[model samples]
Target: MRRGRAKSIPKSQTRRPAEAAGEVARLRQELQEARALLRELAEGGGSVVAKRLASLEEERQIARGQAVEAAMAKSKAEGELRRLQAAIDKAPGFQGWLLRRARRRLETG
Candidate 1:
């Protein structure tokens, strides 16, 4: 039998009490946001709500599509934004900004 060495985690992967708490807070905030969205969507039971839900679903499916496509204007940020936006429609104009802001919080905390 052959044995291999276990992988070691980097310092960034280390969990601290503050970090854990912050993560919990963030997750709770996310859950609240999701609940709010559900409530908003459920408020009206008509073609409008159904159309919005269908649009959101279509965005989700497009995001899941796997293909090798050329980048436009050689803009890498656009690609990343589209990928993240497709997955998260709430932050359409602020996807990249929000991601960077969250990273900053993690680094500062």
Candidate 2:
């Protein structure tokens, strides 16, 4: 099994321009559809649709906020994991320590 960290591929190499463009286009279409729906509800003067839209917008905002909070927590955990790994590395190589212990035992015997 591979130990420690693997090298990261560069963004330019890893990401496809066409895929990113497609994602952006999809998001724009979704936004346009939401706007059209809102306009239709306004034109019909449907209070129910308006109320529902407002509720949905509120929920979307809360969910977005929670996502940002979760991302921050994940980032903090990753940083702490790296710090502890570095500390462990500094303590001494495990194989070398075991070999040194064996040498000391043979000498004493």
Candidate 3:
């Protein structure tokens, strides 16, 4: 049997929590900015209540657009995750080994 040396993989092959956290932080900042802009638009001077209502409606439309963009971004991230997972699952002699290590780390700490 040719059960000799196994290849060692680099740590960068797997996704890290830090990257995910950074992405979340960045998205939060964007959402905060969008909200601030909407608030500004809604609070700006208007001659009539109808005008204010229209401005608020515009703000709502902006919020809806932001929500749709966020949804698309989430879908893209999920697709990327699925691609990575599929790649991991197809690797030889590594799927179960990696899963066990992940489970052990999660369970222990």
Candidate 4:
């Protein structure tokens, strides 16, 4: 009769539990470090995100003001054109005189 040999388990498998625990602890430490960095960035004077938001708001206000100014100027010009057209319709010779006066004023100014 031949003698039978016992099978042996690998050494790495035997040490797997401790290695896994160490890996978990290291990962947890890294996570804590990341969280701390985030907290620090948030608590400091100002973050990049906050600065960008402020700049964007300022630009938005400037754009809104410009839009209002443009609307007012357009309304003013339209009113002047209508008034000038009415005057020209009422007096045939007035349009040429008004044009000459405008040109003279522009040249002088």
Candidate closest to the true structure, highest TM-score: 3
User: What TM-scores do the predictions have?
Assistant: 0.34, 0.44, 0.45, 0.44
lDDT of 4 by residue, 15-78 (tens): 6778889999999999999998788777773776788789999999999999999999999999
The TM-score measured for candidate 1 stands at 0.34
Worst 10 residues of 1 by lDDT: 65-74
| Whole-model lDDT, model 1 | 0.75
Q: Which stretches of candidate 1 lie over 4 Å from their true place?
A: 45-109
lDDT of 1 by residue, 1-109 (tens): 8789978999798999998999999999999999988787687647667898899999887766522233443477788867865655345567656866776687699
lDDT of 2 by residue, 1-109 (tens): 9899999998777758899899899999999999998888788858767898999999999999999999999999999978855554455688656655665687699
lDDT agreement with native, every candidate:
0.75, 0.83, 0.82, 0.83
**Residue pairs with clashing backbones, model 4:** none
RMSD of each: 23.5, 20.8, 27.0, 17.3
Per-prediction tally of clashes: 0, 0, 0, 0
In model 4, what lDDT does residue 48 have? 60
Q: After superposition, how far is residue 6 of candidate 1 from its true place, in Å?
A: 0.9
Badly placed stretches (over 4 Å) of model 2 are 1-45, 92-109
lDDT of 3 by residue, 1-109 (tens): 7797888878888558999899899999999999987777688634456787899999999999999999999999999988866765565677667875775687699
Superposed Cα deviation of residue 87, candidate 4 (Å): 0.5
